[model samples]
Target: MDTIASLFSFITTPVSWIIVQFHKLYGAIFGPDTGWAWGLSIVSLVVVIRICLIPLFVKQIKSMRNMQALQPKMKAIQERYKNDRQRQSEEMMKLYKDTGTNPLSSCLPILAQSPFFFALYHVLSKIASGDTIGVLNQELVNSAREAHIFGAPIAAKFMDSEEKVAALSASLTDVRVVTAIMIVLMSASQFYTQRQLMQKNVDLTVKTPYMQQQKMLMYIFPLIFAVTGINFPVGVLVYWLTTNVWTMGQQMYVINQNPTPGSKAQDNYLQRLLKSVSSHGEVRGRRRRSVVQAIVAKGADRNDNERKFFAGLAKAGFAAQADGTVIKSDTVTADAEAGSAARRQQPKRQSKAQRQSGGTHQTGEAKPSLEKQQDTPPKPAGKSSPATPRQAKSGQRKGSQRPKHPSSKK
Candidate 1:
C-alpha cells in the first residue's frame, strides 16, 4: 500500500497540484462561491493538457503513419523468407529499423496517459469525497469541498462525490445521467477523431495493415470508454470529455493546415465542409471510400497508364530508392527492397546439357578424341576401333590431358 501510494504521488504530485491550483485561480477570478468556476477549471485543465500533449500526439501519429507506409515492405520481407523463421525475424527487425517506425508508437501515448489519469482520479476522489488524500491538509480539503464551477458546486455533480450510484436517489439519478452523457461524449469524440483520421487525415502512403488497425480502433475505443466510463467519477468524465474535445479541435486544425497528401482530409473532409458552407455548396460523398473512388475514376481519365502509375509510386516513394541503390521494380512483391525484384529480372535457368558443357565453347578447335568417340560409328564386333589409331598414335596427348580413372587409393 505504501508502494502504491508512492507511485501515486509521482503523477498526482505535479499535475494534480497544478490542477488544484487552476481550480483556485479560476475560483478567484469567478468568485469563490460559484460552481461555474470549477467547470471553467476543468475546461482549462483540458486545454492545457491538450496543448502539452500536442507534440507527443504528433510524434505518435507520425510513427503510426510510418508504420502504415512500411506495411507492404514488411509483408514482402515476410514472404521472402517464409520458410526461414530465424532469418524472417532478423529481416523484420531490419525492415522496422529501415523504416524508423515502431508499432508500439501507437500505444506509447496511451501508456503515458495512464499515470496522469490515476493521479487525477486520486485528486478528484479527494476533492469530491472530502477524503483529505494524505497530501492535502485539512484547509485544502475544506477549500476543495467548497469549490464550484459557475454556480454549481463540483461536489453536487456526483463526479466529485466518490460514492456509489446506489447511495444517490432516483431524484439524484441526474448525476448518473450527467455522468453517462459525459461518457458518451468522451467515447464519441474518440470515435470520430479516429474515423476522420482514417477517412480523412491519414497519409496516402499509409499501408493497408496500419489502415486496418486504425479502422479497428474506431470500434475498439468507443467500446472501451463506454464500459469504463461508469466506474470513473463524474469529474474524471468531465476531464475526459474535455481532453477529447481538445484533441478533436486540434486535429481539425492540423488537417486544415498540414493535411496529409492523398488523404481524405486534404481532398474532402475540409473541402467538403468548406463547400457545404460555401456559395458553391457542392456536397460530395458522405463516405470517404466513395469520395476517393470518385477521384480515382476522374483522375484515371486524364492520366496515361505509365504516368499515373509512376505518379502514384512517386507520391508513395514506392519506386524511388531510399537506400541509394536503384530498384528494378516489380509490382507483385510487397516489400520495396525484397519484393518481386528477383522475379522481375530473373536470369534464365540453364538446362542440364548447358551445365554439363564445361563453360561456353569457343569456335575453331579440332574435336577432342572424346568428341570423336561420341561421333564415331561402332566398330564390327571382331575389330578394335581404327579411331583408337589416333590415341595410339598420339597417346601422350590423351594421357597428359585426362586420365579416365586413377586407381582407388586405400
Candidate 2:
C-alpha cells in the first residue's frame, strides 16, 4: 500500500491543497479540529473529482451498451476460431476496432480517480505518523490527527494497533467499530448499484457472456471492497463510501430516464409515457420527444416495449406521427371500423329452391297478382290471328310431306 501510495506522490500536494481549501470553508462552522471539518473536506474532494470525471463516466456507459450489443457477433467469432486462440483474439480486436469500442472504457472513471484516492490515503497516513506532507503543515497535520469521526480519529485504521489508536486519542474498539460500519455501507452501496444495473437496465432478451461477466463483477466488487476496506484509513473509508453513494444515485437517475431498449426499465418508462401522453395529449418534454422520435424511426423494428407503447396510444384514441407528436384519431378509426362492419355484413341465406327459381325475391320487386293476370285480354284467338312466319313454319312438315297429305285426303 505504501509503494502504491508513493507512486501517486506527485498528486498528493494538489489533493492536500484542495482538502485544505474545503477545510477552511467548513472549519468556520464546525471547529477547526472537529471531525466534520476534515471528513467533509474529504467528501468535497471526492465530489470535485467525480464532477470532472462525468464525461468519462458517460463514455463508460456508452461503451458498456455497445459491448452488450456486440455480444452476438463476438460469440460467433469466438466459435468460428475456437481452435485457433491467436486468430480468435485477432478477430475480437478487429471487431472492437471497427465498432469504435474500447473494452477498458468502463474502467476509465475508476482509473482516472485512482491517483487522487491514493494521494489522499498517503496524506492521511502521513498525519497518522505525525509527519507533514504536501500543503498539510505540522499545524494542519496535528489538527487532522485530533479530528475524530464518530469517536474514531480521522487518520486511524481498523487494523491500527491499540497503542497507535491511543496515540491519536482514540480506543481500538471505537476505530474498529466505525471502520466496520463504514466498510459494510460502502460494500452494500456498491452491490446495489451493480445489481440494479443488471436487473432493471440490461436487455434481458439477449443471453450473452457480457451479462455473465457483469453478474460475476456484481458479486466480486463488493467482496473486494469488504476485504480491502480494513486497510483503508477512516478518512479514506469516508471518501469511498461517499463516492459509492454518489455512484448509486447517478446510476438510478440514468436507469430511470434513458434505460436500455427491451429492459424492464424501458417497459416501465413507456407505460409512464403512455399515461402522460394520454393525459396531456402531447409529449411533455424534449427528452420525451426524442424518445418518441427514435421509436417512430424504428418503425417495424421497434422492440416489444415500444410496440406496446404504440398500441396503448392507439387504444387511447391517439396516433403517433413521424414528428413525435400525437393527434386525436378517434373519428378516423371509427369510420374505418364502420366501413369494415358494412363490408362484413352478408345477404340473408336462401334455400336451394329459391336459388334455382332465379332468386326474384332477392331483386326486391313485387310480382303481378293472379286476379290481375286473368283480367288481361286473350289476344291469341281473335287475331289467329295473322299466322306469323314462326307459326307457319311450325305447322308445315320439315320436308317431302305432299305425298302423305294426298293419300290421307283420298
User: What are the lDDT figures for the candidates, one per model?
Assistant: 0.60, 0.89
Local accuracy of candidate 1 as per-residue lDDT tens digits, 1-410: 12343477666767656666776787678865455555666677767766776678889878866765566676787677889989987887887787677766766656666666667667766565566664566666666566533223344444334254323221245665676677788999999987777766765343444566777878998899898776676666777788777767877887765555455555444344333323322333444334333444454442232244334443333332322222334552346545457668876676675556544334424345565567666568987864354453543643324435567553
Q: Which ten residues in a row have the lowest lDDT in candidate 2?
A: 383-392
Off by over 4 Å in 2: 75-90, 335-410
Worst 10 residues of 1 by lDDT: 318-327
Clashes of 2: 0
lDDT of model 1, residue 90: 84
Give a tens-digit lDDT track for model 2, residues 74-113.
8788788889999988898899899998887866877898
User: Model 1: what TM-score?
Assistant: 0.57
| Alpha-carbon RMSD, candidate 2 | 7.8
| Residue 245 in candidate 1, Cα distance off native in Å | 0.8
The parts of candidate 1 lying over 4 Å away from their true place are 1-6, 78-91, 146-171, 203-207, 268-410
